[model samples]
Target: MAKEKKYESELLITRIFSAPRELVWKAWTEPERVMRWWGPKYFTSPICKIDFRVGGSYHFCMQSPEGEDFWSTGVYLEIIPLEKIVCTDSFADENGNVVPATYYDMEEDFPLELELTITFEDHNGNTKMVLQHIGIPEGITQELTKQGWNESFDKLAEILE
Candidate 1:
């Protein structure tokens, strides 16, 4: 009998924004604010539906510059105002039904479900935000995901300024 190998990885990114912790928190909890910086550069979030409470869920649609739409949905597992948020993340369809990453033609090794933890701290009147994403497969996909996240954060920084 052959044993199956298990594969799992995580991505961690920390950034300091020149904005108050409350403001940064709102950027995540408020649908309108989220639309301003949800995707990478030149990507517009056409839809953002957020129910900001534990056990609540959010659905978002990020449209690429070339008109491709990528949808994602997540359920809030925990929430602490101006402090932290823990959620279950997953790829989804336009209607917000949970789907595998391969549904979008991504690598087959991508996990069907993922976890995300976001923490915010006060840093000299600014906000220090840390994002921990779990269950991603390591390699090019992870690198691309990191680039996308950094681009999204850059957009968030511009708005905070």
Candidate 2:
């Protein structure tokens, strides 16, 4: 049999915060904390909701510096407390209804749904978080996602501090 093909994510966001694993997980799972650092620089997350369990859902809205609003929703596929989280992320309306990727210009080649696998590891007393986004084509989504995550992580670090 031919070797099974694997889905290699072209976009990955990794950050190690000077905080405990549990605290790092809380920053991701807690809507209130997520609202503090969930968008790119100059962007703000005015709304954030997280169920934070297997099969549960999360939704949030990010307002751009230009005042345009963008919403994103996700369903948790797997969760291991402070260890790992797998979820499906997509553009959505305020009602949490999934919309076309093109609606947000998130992707041009890949499907609307993006798979995100986030892992948190304890590095001494700090937390190492890795966010791997699967199905990110070589386009705007990749750059925008990276920029957003990086900005978010910076905010998270400040929060942890």
Q: Model 1: which residue pairs collide?
A: none
Please, what are the lDDT tens digits per residue for candidate 2 over residues 1-161? 11111144458888889998989999989999999888978889999999888999999999998988899998999998789999988789889998876787544445567788999998877999999987666567568778878988898899998
On a 0 to 100 scale, what is the lDDT of residue 42 in model 2?
83
The most accurate candidate by lDDT is 1
lDDT of 1 by residue, 1-161 (tens): 10121225789999999999989999999999999999999999999999989999999999999999999999999998889999988899999999878888997767777888999999988899999988767889889889999999999999999
Please list the residue runs of candidate 2 whose C-alpha ends up more than 4 Å from where it truly belongs after superposition.
1-8, 105-110
Give the candidate number with the greatest TM-score: 1
- In order, candidate lDDTs are 0.90, 0.84
Clashes of each: 0, 0
